[model samples]
Structures are given as C-alpha cells and as structure tokens.
Target: MNTLYPVMLEPQEPSGYCVQFVDIPGAITEGETLEECLFNAAEALTGVIESYIELGQEIPRPSENIKEAYYIAPDARVQSALLIRWARGDRSLADIARALETSWPSAQRLENPHHSPTLKQLERAASVLGKKLVLSLE
Candidate 1:
C-alpha cells in the first residue's frame, strides 16, 4: 500500500498556510508559502513517526479517504521502517531474523528509521514477512 498521509492546508493570517495531518494529532506545521508548507509537513510527519517508534507506540496508518485533501509522504527511511514494522504485525523480530539467517540485532535494525537498511535487506525482510517491498518516486 502507498503510505501517503492526507493533510489539510488551511490559509493563515496575512498570507501563509498551515498544514494539519488528518490521521495524526499534533502533527502540524506552517510555512509562508504552499511549497514550503508541504515541505514542512513532510518533516513534521517523519518526526511524529520517529517519536512513535521511540515510544513503542503504533504508528497511525494513512487514511484512504483523501478527497480534496493534500497528501504527503515521509522520507524514504521513515517509510521503510514503518512499512517493515507494520508488515511484521504480530510476528517477533527473532522470527524474521531466523528466516533471514541473520542475527536479531541486524533484523531489528530494519525497523530503525535512523538506520538505512540496504535495498537487499529490505527486500529479504519483506519476502520473509510474506509482503513485497515496493518503492516509488514522487
């Protein structure tokens, strides 16, 4: 599934725009222009997700009903980390480690947003999780 979150871009006083994420509470940001606002929104979204991971909280899934709403995606590393964690579901990291024939720490690193896992590592993890790793540009 494409991991694009919907955001509401509201015009602010005097000129700029304020962006609020539809699914994530408190994940809000503002910019002096539409371009800058959307850019800031991406950073805000990534930060929120990173915070969630650090707190061991479940990351909110992107809403699909995006009619008339602007959408944004977090950076690739955050996206990859979230995707792996979400796909792992109830399975243990140790299970994935065993299937990948790697140590637990290595498999665990796949879910660390700060650690950039190689494409091969991500693909193998997805395969073991019975999911496919899909990448996109935009």
Candidate 2:
C-alpha cells in the first residue's frame, strides 16, 4: 500500500504555511517556510500514527484521489510499523509468530513503532504476510 498521505497547505497570516493531512484529523502543523512546513508535517504525521498505535486505534489509510494535495510520508520507523500492521490484517500476532517461527513478543515487536526491527526481520515478516519489502529513495 502507498504510505504517502495527502495534505492541504494553507498560507498563514503574514507568513508560513499550515499543513493538515486530508485523511488524518488532528495531525496538523505550521512552519515559517514551505520546506520547514513539509518537515514539520512529517513529524506531526508520525506523532499522530504513534498515538493511534498506542491507543489501539486503526490508522487511516492514505487517500488516493485527493486533488491539489501535497503528499508526505511519516518517518521510516512509523511507516514500517504501519505497514506490518496493515499487512497482518485480521491475522493474530501469534499467527505471524508461528509463520516466522518466533515468539509472540518478537513478532509483536515488528509492529512496535518505538522498536526498530532489522531490515532482514522486516523482509521476512513481509514475505510471510505475502508482501514484498521494497524500498525507494524519494
């Protein structure tokens, strides 16, 4: 799934730009320049995603058909966590653990935003989840 969230940028009074994710309410930020605004938007998006994970809430998928919207992605760690959770779908953590031949905690850590799972570990998890781990430079 594409992880880039579409955001609307509104010019603030006298200076800067305010950014809000189209599909994620409460994830907003502003900065003094377009570059800074984009940077802060990424941070804001990551924070909101982490909060969603902590609250056991489903993270909203990125909208594909938004017009005149700029796209931004969360930090790599958050993106990895979200991808793992989305790939797991209705499958239990135990199910993933069994497929990976690992303990439940280890498999659970793969989806932890705070815990950095190795690339090999992520690749293995993706394989088990019927996904291919593909990385690209933006």
Candidate 3:
C-alpha cells in the first residue's frame, strides 16, 4: 500500500517556505518556491520514514485534516519495498529472498534504508509480494 504523509508548510520570514511533517518528527526542510517546497517535502518525509523503517521503528499514521499530503518514496530499490511487502503479511524474508534470487541476508538488507538494493531486485520482490512499484519524479 502507498503511504501518504501530511505536511505543514509555512512561509518563512523574508523568503522561502519551512516544511514540516506532522507524523514525522525531525523531518523539516525549506524551499524558495512552492515547487521547491513540494519537492523538498517529499524528500524529507521519505527520509524520515525510511530511517524509521531502517531502525525497525513504527511508521506513524497520518493525522486528520492534512492540507498538503505527500507520497512516500524512499526509492523503489530501498527499504520501502521490503517494508511494504512485510507489512502485507504475505511472505517471510526467506520466501522473498528466493523470489529475489538473493541470499536471505541480502533480502533482509533490502529492508534496510542504509543499504541500497538494485531497482530490478526491488521490482522482483514487489512482484513476488503482489505489488506494483510505482516511481515518479516531482
């Protein structure tokens, strides 16, 4: 499932915008324009959640009435794929590893945000988990 994070954007004094995510503490960024703010917001949110996933911490649910919602994209070849797949309760690391054509340790590392995986490998793992990985540029 795709996770949507709510962000609060405030115009900074003089210039730029300060972006803060409600559910993701320590996730803050700034941009000179709305476009840039939106882009940075995605990056910040992704980074926060990816860190949480990497640390095996909880991913917070979105709060109510979030005006600006950002999509979570911690890179398709990163831990987000493994987190999503595991969250589905459809398979174990061993099962996903076999489908990914890699070792179990590699499969486990696929869930580590600090460890990058090949996009092809993430795609294969997503397929095995019955998910279609969608990636886009802002």
Candidate 4:
C-alpha cells in the first residue's frame, strides 16, 4: 500500500526552501528548489520511518490539518543533493539498483527527479537509502 502524508513547505532566508512534516517533529528537509525540497523531505521522512522500524518504534501518521504554504514545480537541486548525499555516504547507485532489483540505468533515472519515478521505485530507493516510504492523506 502507498501512504501520502501532508508536508508544509516554508521558504527560508537567503535562498532555497524547507519542508516540515505536520505530525513528525524534527522531521524536516531543505533544498534549493521546491521540487528538491519536497523530494528531500520525502526521503527524509522515509529515513525517519526506517529508523523507527529498526528500533521497533511506532511511526507517526499525518494530521488532518496538513497544508502547504507555497507551491512550485520540480527542481534539479533536490536530485543533485540526493545524489551527492548518496555518494558521500558511500552509497552506490549500482547498489541501490541491485537492492531494488533494477538496472543501473533505471536507478540512474530515479536519481533524476525529472525522470518521473513511480511510487514503488521511490519506495525502493528510499529503502536502499536506509529509509522507509510512507504516504498519508492531507
């Protein structure tokens, strides 16, 4: 099953943006663009879920009051940051591909937000990134 949660997008000082989970405290992410910020927020949420699961903890569900302060299209900065973190963390695209049982190029496509990754693929990518996928209604 797929879970979609409500996330709040807030603009930050200087440049870039940040995301906040309505139900999860300290669960935040930022990026140079709205797309990147949102995507990173998703990934960050996944990671938080994974950590909870690993520790046999409970996951936080989204609240009914979820709302977005702003709206923007996808951006490349999010993909780049995700890729950079994956690389810096010594996480290989090939490894993620293998974990998701996909081809390297396919995995590469996922790293590119512009490629339009499916929810399942994103879930797998999150798993490979040591995260869990969750979606909740707003």
Per-model TM-score on C-alpha atoms: 0.96, 0.97, 0.67, 0.47
Kindly indicate the candidate among 1 and 2 with the higher lDDT: 2
Q: How would the candidate models be sorted by TM-score, starting from the highest?
A: 2, 1, 3, 4
Better of 3 and 4 by lDDT: 3
- Expressed as tens digits, the lDDT of each residue in 1-138 for candidate 3 is 545567777888899988888777888999999889878877777677777776767676657665555444445444464455456474688977787788989888767766776777667767877877676564
Better of 1 and 4 by lDDT: 1
**Per-model C-alpha lDDT, please?**
0.91, 0.93, 0.69, 0.59
Clashing pairs in 1: none
Model 4 lDDT tens row, 1-138: 223456777778898877877766656888998778777876776666545534535455445544543322223333332432344256676877788788988877764433556677666677767666564433
TM-score of candidate 1 relative to the true fold: 0.96
Q: Considering summed lDDT, which 10 consecutive residues are worst modelled in model 2?
A: 11-20
What's the CA RMSD of model 4 in angstroms? 11.2
Show where candidate 4 strays beyond 4 Å. Answer: 69-138
**How does model 4 score by TM-score?**
0.47
- Model 2: CA > 4 A from native: none
Q: Compose the digit string of candidate 1's lDDT tens values, residues 27-109.
A: 99999988998899999999999899878997888998778788999889889999999999999999999999999999989
lDDT order of candidates, top first: 2, 1, 3, 4
Counted clashes in each candidate structure? 0, 0, 0, 6
